[model samples]
Target: MRIESESAKNQWVTAAFECMLDGGLRNIRIEALARALGVTKGSFYHHFANRAELVRAAVERWELEGTDAIIALANREGAPAERLHRLLGVIAGSSAQQGRGELMLFLEASDEGVGDAVARVTGRRIAYVAQLLEEHGVPSGLAQRRAVMAVAEYHGARVIAAGTDSLPVDERVLDVGDAIRFLETTLLAP
Candidate 1:
C-alpha cells in the first residue's frame, strides 16, 4: 500500500500523530503505521523517506498548529493583563491535551537526532510569546526571560497534572496562572 500522492503523505502524518498520542513516539513504527492506515510500508516510504522524516513532519505540525493558535489568542488587542491571561489559557489548554506522558516522550525525541529541528520550531514559539510580552511594553531582556519561564512552567504543570488523578482542574489552572502572573509582574515589570 504505497502512498500515491502528497495527500497520502499527510495521511501518514495524521496516522503517526494518532499513534503517538495513543502510545507515545516509541511505539510509532513504519509497519504499525502502514497497517493502521491500511497501506504498505512502501506507501509510507513514498511519502516519507523513513521514520525520521515522518517524526520531523509530526513535530513540525505540532509546533505550527499549537503555536499558531496560541499566537492568535495572545495577539488579540487588549490590556496587557488580558493578553497574558489569554496566553496562559493557550498554554494550559495545549498542555492538558498533550498530558505529561506524551510530553516526556516528545522531550526525549527532541534530544535525539530530531533535537535541532524541534529546537528551531520551539524557538519560534518562544519568540512569538516573547514578542507578545514586548508588545505590552515589557523590557527586551525581561520579555525573553518571561517567555522562557512560561514555557518551563507549562511543562512543569503537565508533569504535575500527570502524577495525580486527584488533582482538580481549578488547582492546575490556578497554579499555571499564578506562575504566569508572577513572571509578568516580577520579570516583566519596569
Candidate 2:
C-alpha cells in the first residue's frame, strides 16, 4: 500500500482498538469500524482483506502500545530498581477500562495471528522482566522464576482492578499500590 493508505490503515487499526475497548473484540466488524471512523467499508477493504485481518492488526497495535511502549518508557531509567518502579507506575496508571479491554482481547483470542501475537507479547514481557531482575543481582534461574511470578501478579492485579467497580476508587488505587510495592520489595530483595 502507499504511504497515505498505510496511514489510513493505521486509523482503521486504531479505531478498531478503541471499539474493542468500548465494547469487545466482537465490536470490531468492518462496518462498525467504518461507521465509527466516519468512513466506508470500502476504506476498510482497502486496508484489510477481512475482519480477521483487522483483528490481527488491532492485536499488534495492542502489543505495541501495551507492552513494547511501556518497556521503552521504563528503560529510560538507569538503575534496574528505578526501571521496575517506572514500569509498575506506568502499568498501574492505566485505566480500569484498558485492563478490562485487555482481558477481553485475551479471552477473544481465537484467531491464529491474534493468539500468536498474544503469546509473543507475553513471553517478551516476561523476558524483559527477567532481564531487569538479573540486572538487580538476582540469580539467572531465580530471576526467571520471579519474573514469571511478577508478570502473573501484574495480570492478576489487572483482573482484580477490572472487577472491583463496587469499591471506592481511592481504595482500589490503594489496594493496587500496596500490591505493587510488595512486588517491588520481593523482587528487589537480597
Candidate 3:
C-alpha cells in the first residue's frame, strides 16, 4: 500500500520522531505509529520503504531539529560568552525534551545509522562549544577539553532528567540550570 504527497511523508517522519522521543526506538513500530497518527499502515509504507528507512528519517529529523537548528540559533551575533550563555540557557529551558538524544545513544550498538547520527551531532556540538571557548581566548587544547566536559555535563543532565519526567518540569529545568551553572563556574571561571 502506497500513497503520494511529500507533506504526508514528512508527517510520517515527524510522527516517527515524536514516537521515538516518547518511547525510544522500540516505539517506532509502523503499525503503532500509524495507529497513533490515525493513519493506516499503507500510508507509512508509502512514505517509507520499510521500518528502517522510517527510523532513519526519524533520526534525521531529530538531528536537524535537536542539533543543527540549535547550533544555528546559538550562532547569532553576540560576544562568545554571551552566545554561550544563550545556548546554555536554551538548553536548560528545554530540559523536558533533553533525554531523547541520550536515549538514542543506546541504539549505537544496534543501528549504525543512529550511531553515526548521534556521533555527528555530538561532534558538531562539541566543536561549536570549543569554538566559542576559543573565541573567549581560551587556549585551543584547554578549550577542547572544557568543551567536552561542558557537553558531558549538559547531556548528563539530559540523561538524568530522562528518567524523572514524573517530577514537575520546573524542578527538572532547575536541576539542569544548576548543573549548567556549576559547569560554567568550574570551566568558565577566571
Which consecutive 10 residues in model 2 have the weakest lDDT in total? 164-173
Q: How many backbone clashes does candidate 1 have?
A: 3
Each model's C-alpha lDDT?
Answer: 0.69, 0.81, 0.74
Which residue pairs of candidate 2 clash? none
Give one digit per residue, the lDDT tens place, for model 3 in 1-190: 2333657888888778887776677677788777767778887777678988988888888788877888889888899887888788777667355365446545542653567777788898899999998998888999999999988877665665666547554462466557667766666654
Residue 71, candidate 3: C-alpha displacement in angstroms: 1.0
Q: Model 1, 169: alpha-carbon shift in Å? A: 8.9
What lDDT is obtained when candidate 1 is compared to the true structure?
Answer: 0.69
Model 1 segments more than 4 A misplaced: 1-6, 95-97, 164-190
Between candidates 1 and 2, the one scoring higher on lDDT is: 2
Which model scores highest in lDDT?
Answer: 2
Model 3 spans > 4 angstroms off: 1-6, 97-101, 104-109, 164-176
Query: In order, how many clashes per candidate?
Result: 3, 0, 0
Which ten contiguous residues of candidate 3 have the minimum total lDDT?
100-109
Mind giving the per-residue lDDT tens digits that candidate 2 earns over 1-190?
1224648888888888887776568778777667667777788888788888888888888888999999999999689999998998898888778877887777777643477787888899899999999999999999999999998887776676666558544443567678679989999887
Could you arrange the candidates by TM-score from highest to lowest? 2, 3, 1
In the predicted model 3, the residue pairs found to clash are: none
- TM-score, cand. 2: 0.88
